[model samples]
Target: MDSDELREVLQEAGLSPYQSKAYVALLELGTASARELVEASDVPDPRIYDVVRSLEDRGYVETYEQDTMRARAHSPADVLDDLQNRASRFEQAADEIEDRWEQPELDRHAASIVKRFETVVDRARLFIQEAENQIQLSASIEQYEQLRGVLADALDRGVYIQLSIYTNPDDDVELPAEEQLAATTTEARHRPIPSPFVALIDRQKACFGPHEDALNEYGVLVDDRMHEYIFHWYYSSCLWEICDEIYSSRNDEPPIEYVDVREFIRDVEPMLLDDLSVGVRVVGKDVSTGEERELEGEVADVFYEGDDYRGTREIPLAQLAGRASVTVATDEGEFTVGGEGAMLEDVEAMRLTITSASE
Candidate 1:
């Protein structure tokens, strides 16, 4: 490499300017005294000893004592190995510290943003490794193009694979490079889902995103075990079961038309409402009095009188900020009640829980 590039690399390797120059000089000259080193390199005389000592401590240099002290630079391979080892140690320590301090929040937001294909690809890679028994993938031609390699890798390792593709009928379907790798080693199959999102990876991970036209607008990976479990319940037990029946009967028709009220609500509201408890606020003028009254608490029930118009009744709690309130529990004392509007706002910001302090 050129001097400029080498210097930049040294900087990345955690070397100071003078240290890099001094080390490079030693490398060229083999062995040199402090005076010779100072004259040959850009390092000043006063800082030479400190720089030499730093290099020696880092195992990049060896110092010899005689009438005059001399130092020799270590081989590039040895120096590079030492630097890499030190870096690995630092990274392991940092990961431990972060695990203790930031893991809870880190896992929550790791796949929230879908800025680039790389982020989704990485999440898919992680999911493949985490998958113990099964993987279900549904994606557009474009998404599958990016994820083919990850799927193939998982299949090679003996993980069960089931993939569904959503593409135009005229579009040519081909496995991604990675998927091709696993195709020979694992069970691989594909079908079509009308929707563009992909959701299958054992019961541990799920990647949901937009169709081709809206690709840049939405994408998310759910890695949390609790979230994945809930999704599996709905997808496997409810959605996929009916989808299987439809496929077997060659009924390529929309299944919602056949679903009962309970299934209809589940299909319409993709949001898992079982583990979810909602808060509601009613703001209206009392019919008996001319005064305005607001009632807010955990939503006991939500009923719709007509399309686009919904009514909710919540147990009254102490009033808080505008139309919001705090529910006082018998044992837990008091906790703020956040309504559906607030929940929607939170979701847009990539937040999952209203109880988050940062929100």
Candidate 2:
């Protein structure tokens, strides 16, 4: 290599610029006095002695007295060997430091803000994988596509999922057939408004906030169940059902089924205890004809069955000219309600629907 390239290599291997130049000059000159080095290597006259001494100390050069001291560059192999030893020490120290480092657990309830999009996606993946029973998620179509693989894995693990896709309200967004087909097992829908991004797990934890952008893009993670429930309800009552359900001629069935009145009552007891009303739509199956029907209502009463809470809800029936009350048992699972043998238990799937804010 040329002198300039060799100097750069030596400096990269840990030598100072003056040391590199002096060493390279000595290699070419065979042996050189300090004055010769300054002329040949362009090292400043005042710093040449210190540079040569440093090179000698690093084992890159040897000095001998010849009236005045003269320096000789060590064999190229020897100088490189010394540098290699230094590189090895650096690697060892790095490994030791890494081993001693302890990363603290991230506080989910804390308001952590990540500005990078990649970090936001990575955190979202952790939230999905950490979910036990359910995952409630809302994102723009682009964001959803980015996380589809992680979400598919969550579903494979039997975690029930509710996904909502957000898009422009004024434009017709064509749904990708394969993407829609892949989510048949989960409750997936679309909304026209630009909804906030959200991911809630079992109503126990959540990460939610605005989309990624050049501005202050961030998310708030809540581990406190009570705080997460606010997000849960918002996801269920707003983002999840804010727009018309996406339908396709090729799609086989609806992504969601109504909860039986019995299951609905049991699932919503927490809200009742908090003196909050939860609106649920119950889809009943006709046993004889295999026909399906629905009833929308609110919880009206609560009772205890051993350790679990059971409750009742009243649904107004136009045929009966009055409201019909249905008893819901957590342990019993399903039952029948009203006059026309409209079966309430074990019909299909159950889901929460959007309700009026006042209700």
**Predicted model with the maximum TM-score:** 2
* lDDT (tens digit, per residue) of candidate 2 on 198-258: 8877555677767543266645656666677567657766786455665422223222233
The runs of at least 3 residues in candidate 2 whose Cα sits more than 4 Å from the true structure, single-residue gaps closed, are 1-104, 170-172, 178-181, 212-215, 247-359
Please give the lDDT score for candidate 2. 0.57
Error of 1 at 331 (Å): 45
Model 1 C-alpha lDDT per residue in residues 54-87, reported as the tens digit of each score: 9888867666553578776533444445445655
- The lDDT per prediction is 0.47, 0.57
Clashing pairs in 2: 257-349, 258-350, 259-350
lDDT (Cα) of model 1: 0.47
Q: Which candidate number maximizes lDDT?
A: 2
Task: Give candidate 1 misplaced runs (Cα > 4 Å).
Answer: 1-111, 170-194, 233-359
